[model samples]
Target: MLNVLSILIGLLSLVIVIPAQIPFLGIANWIALPFIVVGLVIGQLSSSNGGRNLCLVIFAVAVVRLMLGGGVI
Candidate 1:
């Protein structure tokens, strides 16, 4: 379910964050953002703290990317 997707997108985010400046791939993070948000919402719907925590970590990484001016530019 969403827990699995959250984990997958979370890992994907790590890779995307690094190569986000590669022109065509620069939109990768932006694309993943929706998936990440979906995962977060779905994770919250579940009762497991682990799922929510993983989503949060993904969110944190997204935030860090923004703070570092890593958004699509």
Candidate 2:
């Protein structure tokens, strides 16, 4: 159950991240970070690592984007 919830949250953050990929929209990723963190925490509580791994990947993408944008675009 927790894993499922984490995945849902990760997907939600992914939605935000997709749009944030647009130039000058990178700030949206900052907004999505909290959601991603929440998902990670929830995922950590579950027995399976799938959701946790998903969140980690999403987190990495967001962070890399942020770096490319120099924190803001």
Candidate 3:
């Protein structure tokens, strides 16, 4: 259940970021970071491979966002 919640939170973060304006990129990613962290922790705790995969995806998105200069102020 926690794994699912984590995935959902990560997905919600993606949804939140998708339509963000350039000026709001930093704020959007900052908001998303907690979701990503939670997802990763859940993934580590869960034995399911799918949960781990979702966490990987969340990490990838975070990396991309950072690379795009979105998550840093």
> Which one wins by lDDT: 2 or 3?
2
Residue 61 of candidate 1: its Cα lDDT?
65
RMSDs, each prediction? 3.3, 0.5, 2.6
- TM-score of candidate 2 versus the correct structure, residues matched by position: 0.97
Query: What is the per-residue lDDT of model 3 for residues 1-73, given as tens digits with 9 covering 90 to 100?
Result: 7667767766776776665436545567667767777777887777665666776776676667666773573
- Model 1's C-alpha root-mean-square deviation from the true structure amounts to 3.3
Q: Candidate 3 — worst ten consecutive residues by lDDT sum?
A: 17-26
Instruction: Indicate the residue-level lDDT of 52 in model 3.
Output: 60
Candidate 1 overall lDDT versus native: 0.64
Clash counts per candidate, in order, are 0, 0, 0
lDDT of 2 by residue, 1-73 (tens): 9999999999999999999999999999999999999999999999998899999999999999999999987
lDDT of each: 0.64, 0.96, 0.67
lDDT (10s digit) by residue, model 1, range 2-42: 57666666566556655764544556667667766777787
The deviation in Å at residue 13 for candidate 1 is 4.7
Decoy 3 TM-score against native: 0.68
